[model samples]
Target: MTVILLAGGLGSRMYPLTRIVPKPMVPLAGKPILEHIVDYLNTRGFKEIVIAARYLGEQIVRYFSNHPHAKPVLLDSKDTADAVRLLGNYIRDHFIVAMGDVICNADYSEIYGYHLSANPAATIALKQVENPLPYGVVYLDENMDVALFVEKPVSLEAYLLSLAYYRRRSTSAYENLVNAGIYVFNPYVLEVLERNPGLMDFGRHVFPYLVENGFKVKGYVLSHRVYWSDIGRIDTYKSVMWDLLDGKIAGIKPPATEVSPGVYIHPSSDVRGEIRPPVYIGREVRVKEGAVVGPYAVLEDGVVVEEGSRMVESIVWHGTIVGRDSVIYDSIVMNNVKISRETRVYSSIIGTRRIVSGELRNSIMEPVEVVSPYAQSA
Candidate 1:
């Protein structure tokens, strides 16, 4: 089956980092989140993959092309409906389509199986989250069919978010299944998508149409216990990386990137330094000595933690530099960033190329918005 991965979001919440790479390419557990996603799909014998991208779409295409495994396809477009419709038109059979930005350990085998067995126009992978307001919530029927759909309700009450909890919601109200951004679609559904290219999301658009227009759409609540975190924000990115750095979750078995006696780097990396361990680094990276890299932190590849700089509990991404003697703690440095000497950073996301000198105290260094006790960006 072919899988269409939606990787088109601007990743506004994951700026700087997203500024350099698509969210699907974001680092997670010492590997690109997309890699993990692909690995999962590959394990299921699904080799043909399509990534629907917009921002930095070529990067995703390039990264996959260089590395051989599953042959991945990239589509850079603004319309999700058109992407899916095109994909559906190409694959004239039942197929899987998933989110390109999902950061989870969910397995698609069962979800895919139920979809085929039920033979519906579409089969949605769902979960009911405690706070259903921020997600595409749904209600399921007794026959495991979706009866209602709600896209991100702003309710504070716990909605018990899980594909399983949909047992109650899908049977009771508006959204029967909480969308997990995974779906199985039959070729017959292509006309629906083709007719409605303006639809924002599959859950919000196509599924509702199917339900209202007498289309058979079902829900398969995945019964697996896996760690899934959406790393679309600085906080989430930091948390997911920390879990990998600390061995908190077992998602994809990451490629070996460790070199030094104690350091643990990603397989897709290049480093030239005597680094210490308890560190997590991303793919296609570089590192230099006197850089005192990590005891409990990470350095995403293409990242340059220059001499005399010390990074702890911080995530520095591609094309970034932490200058000499600069101390960074509990911070996230985005791509294309530059940090000067003797600077102190903590608890913030430093945007791309924010010049720094002196000391910074709890700040999100935006584009050219320096935080050091020095002159500002011109």
Candidate 2:
């Protein structure tokens, strides 16, 4: 079956990082998030894949140019439904749709089988979250049919009112099942799209329309053990990285060799410093003497950590250099950045290809030619 991977959003939430590359292009483990998704889909036996991308989409095109089955389609639309509507010709029959930013190890084969068995107009994959306010909350009946859908309840009163409506009908309301941003739809859904020309989003528009118009919409609730995260923000991105290192995610593994219990280092890497567990040192990395790296650190390919430096709970992308005596705590230093001597980075995100020469705390350093605003004496 053909799967449409929607990846066209501008990703304004990720800011400078998304400015450099699309959200799907964001590196995770040792490859882009999109690559992981594609590889997983390939393993699941998906033959044809179309990637809908814009806003630095050429990078995605270039990356997948030689691929046999996966192809990139550049579109100018900003909305999810619109992207699919533009590719309506590609939808020959029943198809699967997934968001590009989400990282999920869901069983697509099982979801497809469930969809075919239920015979609904559309089937939505749902996952329970502790806090449903940030996501599109879904209310399902006893038969696993969607009763109501609310896209990111704006206020507590609104959420409570929706919960109340669900509580009156079924006790399932207690389970906070939110939209997982993956769906299987029948071909007639294309007719619905054509009927509503202005429909732009699936959560805010399409799903609700399908439920209210008496079309059968099924809900496939994932098990509690399943892992799913839309890495839309900085903290979630960092947390997902930690989860990958901890082996919390199934069907995905770090692209490195395990030297010790939880320490993964590439064969070409040179390490003279001390390394704690749960760390990943990538290709050609160099950790100079007296440096301490670990306990949730991912130093990507070609990264150099100088002597006396310490990095904890941080991710330094490919080709970045950490100067001597520097400290990186709970931060993400993007690709090719240069951290000067004795610098301190705490809970911040340093953008790509920049020179950091100061102390940054709880801030986001944009990708600009000028040095960081917090520059100070080492």
Candidate 3:
């Protein structure tokens, strides 16, 4: 089957990071999330894959080209709908369209089967989440046919009241499912999209239009316990990373090879520091004496943690040098960064090639050459 991965949007939520690479190209457990997505699709019997990429899309194109797996078609487009439209002749009779940032382990085959059995214009994968306020909720009838769709209700009370207007049970909002950002579409649906050129989005326009026009659109509720995470923002990105470290996200396993209980150190690295459990030290990493790497820390290739430094619940990317006596906690240090001695960092994001030294709490340091206390004071 053909799968269209919508990866075009500039990941504004993940700013400085996306400034370096696209959202899909963001590393999760040392592998680009887009690579993970491709692996997931490949296993599901998807022969042909198409990536809809625009902002910093060249990176994605280069990454896959160099790696050489499915060799997916990279369609440069501004919108998802336009991307689909651009695939004029390539559009198959049945296909899947999914968001690139979503890390979900749903059975695509089952959803495809459900679509074929129900014979609807479209079948959207739905998941039951506790708080559906942030997402577009899908109301399904007894037969699993979508009854009403509410796009991100303001509050729980508002959602309940909206349900009450349609005579649907108030409790339905709590028990109802939300769109999982996964869709199965037929060729006819493309014609509908072509006719409705004004319809920019699938959630805000196409699905609503289909529902209004009495088009049979079904909801496939994922029955099994599946791991699903929308890694859109900084918090969610960290969450996915933590989950990968903890081995929470199914299907995609972390590249952590533990030499001791909860302590993973790459063979190529030289570690002399006291490392606590649940730590990952990548290749060519150097943790000097008197340094404490711990609790939950991930140091990528070429990372150097100097003496007297302490890191906890932090992720240090490639070529970063943690200077002596630096304390990094609950932060993400990107590629080629330098943290000067005695610097204290907490809950911050140090971008690529940055040089930070000072007491920074909840700070976001971009890719600057130097960001020291003296530099800022002067």
Clashes of each: 31, 0, 1
Candidate 3 lDDT (Cα, 0 to 1) = 0.80
lDDT-superior candidate, 2 or 3: 2
Best by lDDT: 2
- TM-score: which candidate is best? 2
lDDT, candidate 1, at 104: 61
How does each model score on lDDT? 0.68, 0.86, 0.80
Candidate 3 error regions (>4 Å) = 72-76, 153-160, 163-174, 260-264, 369-378
Per-residue CA lDDT of model 2 for 120-154, tens digit only, reads: 99999999889877777788887889988766556
Stretches of model 1 off by over 4 angstroms after superposition: 66-76, 153-177, 197-200, 257-263, 266-278, 282-296, 302-308, 367-378
Q: How many backbone clashes does candidate 3 have?
A: 1
**Clashes in model 2: which pairs?**
none
- Give the worst 10-residue stretch by lDDT in candidate 1: 369-378
Judging by lDDT, tell me the better candidate of 1 and 3. 3
Residue 180 shift from truth in candidate 3, angstroms: 0.7
Q: Which stretches of candidate 2 lie over 4 Å from their true place?
A: 171-174, 369-378
